[model samples]
Target: MTGATYDALVIGSGPNGLVAANLLADAGWSVLVLEAQPDAGGAVRSSHELADGFVHDTFSAFYPFARASPVMLGLDLERHGLTWSHPPAVQGHPFPDGSWALLHRDRGITADLAERAHPGDGEAWLRLCADWDAIGPALIDALLTPFPPVRGGLGVLTRLRHVGGVDFVRTLLSPALTMLDGRLGGEALRTLVAGNAGHADIPLDAAGSGMLGLLLTMMGQTVGFPAPQGGAGELSTAMVRRLESLGGEVRCDAEVVAVETHRGRATGVRLRSGERYAARRAVVADVGVEALYRHLLDPSDVPARVVRGLDRFEMDPATVKVDWALDGPIPWASAPEHAPGTLHLAASRAEMAGATAQVASGYVPAHPFMLAGQMTTADPTRSPAGTEAVWAYTHVPQQTRGDAAASGPGGTGGTVGGDWGPDDRERFADRMQARFEELAPGFGSLVRARRVLGPRELEQRNANLVGGAVGAGTSQLHQMLLFRPVPGQWGRAETGVAGLYLGSAAAHPGGGVHGAPGSNAARAALAHARVSALTALPRSVGRSVRGTLGRGTAGGGAS
Candidate 1:
């Protein structure tokens, strides 16, 4: 208290850390946040230098999760200079034949469009949307809250039980391609749904990939893929403003090198610059488990079993992103109804599946499945007059060394360039542009200026985005739920470490701009501090299961 030491110290000024700091500060505890970058938002910041009067979102353009996240809604960012703009239609998928499938905010209109493209698809679309409407809210709640989703999940189960669990699981587990094949047979309709599913790291053939398609499309129909007014960074700016309003302080250019310990409890942190800051309450880390357990903490300080378990951690596939300042809008033949929404360019569900397979083999597909957004169409503020800001991103396999000879069978028969450098990115970008041109004619002429970001660039910008994984880690079955980061330890943020906690996307409920991990970590730390403070008093304090200390801390350096 003498030197301005606070009750809690949060490492990393990403959404999670900012949310945690805000929560603790609201509870009357002084909070300090240390960030490595000059800015606060990890993957949510924006810049305007791409063009005059054009603000481009550096990463993460759409915010379906942000809109649906209970934490975000509760924060009421709108009142804090954050407004959302949802285009009439949420997304579209263009095909080689000039026709396209679009997802409109109005379900009936979208169904009509699907029906026009493929007979009987209207009913199938309606049925899918209806089923999603019944459980979508509950599912969103279940996903955003702490794992095992004690409350929201119960609500979901109750609803699902009334409808029958077998049917529920079957509906949720249906493959995107299978569903599209059975319902929407047209190539365009199939591409639309498959494109939404591919937004996550999961392949079209992955078991849970169907959920991404269904949930995102359904959410688009229900809420739309809205962007924060002005720019995506405005969302983070609002969170930062709110945190500062609550008396929380953020220190940029401060990277935590290690978490200091005493008597097996996290005592404080040492910055990369050799400055030390102690937390009387807790040290919440808004980074991936790899960095938290394998890099920051000493392996000797952590349990041997924990270190061994860390070896099993898997990262999502890396990505290649391209941003273009266009002289004019993409010229599509008989433009889709919702040109303002996202444009997915894949001919068929089979084609998308093949593309993922190709990427898994370390080869860039001849027809890569890409999700392209016309930011100027969605939010006019993103670009200048008579111009457009186009953003596109696609994924590739991780850990592919620059030697095709070293790659095993089923691998792409070409060496992946070192770290997906600028030259490689430009080549990939050209291929993508050509692919887009094939789907949407005159697409190439619109580009006035362009910039590309690859896996290495993404990692260098934000450590949380390891291997250019925007989601922090893969959303595969093995890496989800309590198994996230590691199994057997789910609820509390503590990693068996005394005061250290995992409050990043690598934790439960995984990535997006949601702040559930941070909120959960703050609550846990607050509870622990309260119990510890009470115990020090003269009177005896009754202990409860929630407040009871578990096993020893699982300490280790982060990956």
Candidate 2:
């Protein structure tokens, strides 16, 4: 009820938070975003920490999910200073046998490459691409839409009716490892398929996970792996700028410690600084599910069922990312195309599986699958000319069992401890670097400077990446789609509390900078606001009528 009041108070000025704020403000509502970090964008930030003039994307780099995202593309980010850089080839997976599987942006060229590898593999690629065309649009719609996905789901069903219902459902939920195993003859092609899906914490054999890679790969094929011209942070800058232009304000370093509520509804928020802001319409939380329910709100206000479900809400695999200000482009045995686009260092399907299994067992994998990006190749502005700013990240154990067997490959037979200290960081980072060295000799010498961030460091940078689980939470079978974040609040942004919404990666459509969680949260808040108004209309009218009648009765008595 003061100057500080806003129509909506969004906690955490991440991409999702800004999306909600921008949408709310664009709809003629006052919105304010509170960020814990000094800057916005959450995980999608870039910095020159590696070395001066060498801009390294601190967290996420590739934008397959973001680029093809309906929410992102529809937002007109280009007009807000977000420029995309695409490499000649979208992605390449090279093997030790002087061969690689290159996914070209051009379908014909990709098909030709596939045909050269295996007889019918080329046709399989075409058929897969065609299958994508059939349901891809509908699938994207279904993914971005709020849960239940009536229209988008039905659209996909209609498109795939000829594919047969049983097989259709099977394909939708099939594991990527299973889908591409025998169909794509060569290990190179198979690795490409499964490796793409492995981008998430979900294992290769996990059902409902095969769809992840298929979706990303198809999206990459259509639109190359585009990143911001300057760095990943530029995308965030554009979104924040767009939000500000819409009259919404983002306050960085505003740590939201609690969600102030009255009568079972979110009333406002209290920052750690002890500052408070009233929410006239809603309080949308772009924080994690655990953080929102366990810490942000009072225990009594949170639903008991939600608290219990939070316990079961599996955290995704932990990631260890290393960025280096390299002297020059990576010298790969496979030559130029090896380091182009977003590259996966894992060689075979078996290799990917073993690494994921190690992660599953809470063991630091000796041979972890790594995803490295050649920033200079995509956008030269990321570093000085002739030099490459490269980054590689791989999943590690969230907690070690303290068993000696958990030590990374070829190690003594015991746990090295779970904490990510300087030793742990350097040791694992060396293993990852050595992996690159195997694929591209002399990879270690190219580094002029490097920054290594394990789970703890990543969590310290962004709390939303709890335990360094980057995909927000596990992309597991029981946690996908409607079951994501939580079972009840799937597909929508509103949380258990009325007038409160979860807008972070922990919400429906889970993880990635695609903006589905934020957009959907905004839409949900708007929908709830409309419903509240409609429901209160008759009550408000009745109250007015009674007041008038009471006044009339009082006047008559006076007379």
Q: In lDDT terms, how accurate is model 2?
A: 0.81
Q: What is the C-alpha lDDT of each candidate?
A: 0.77, 0.81
TM-score per candidate, chains pooled: 0.91, 0.93
Q: lDDT tens string, model 1, 1-559?
A: 1235778899998889888888888899888999999988888888876767777888788888777777777888777889898766789876666777788888888888878877888887787777777778888887777666767777788778654477667757877666556556566556677788888767778778887787887778888899888887888899889888888888999888898889889888888788888888799999988888878898777766567767887788788888888888776666776665577777777778887777677665656678888888898888878888888888777865332323322223333464577666776777667766766677778877777888888888888888888887888878887787777675347688887788898887787777888877877787677556656755534344324543221221100
Give the per-residue lDDT of model 2 (tens digit) for 1-559: 2339999999997788888888888889999999999999899999987787899998999887777777787779899988899877888887777688888888888888888887778887887787777788888888877776778878887888655556756876888888766457766567787888889888888886788888888888887788899998999999889988888888999898999899999999998878889998899999998999999999999987687788898888888999999998888877744246788877678889888888788777767788988889888889999899999998877776442235555323333465888877887777778787887888779899989998989999999999889978888868877787877665456677888988899988888778888887888787677555555768878577556555322110111
Off by over 4 Å in 1: 1-3, 161-164, 180-190, 401-418, 537-559
lDDT of 1 at 23: 86
Give every collision pair in model 2: 147-491, 176-210, 403-414, 403-415, 404-413, 404-414, 404-415, 405-413, 405-414
Could you tell me the TM-score of candidate 1? 0.91
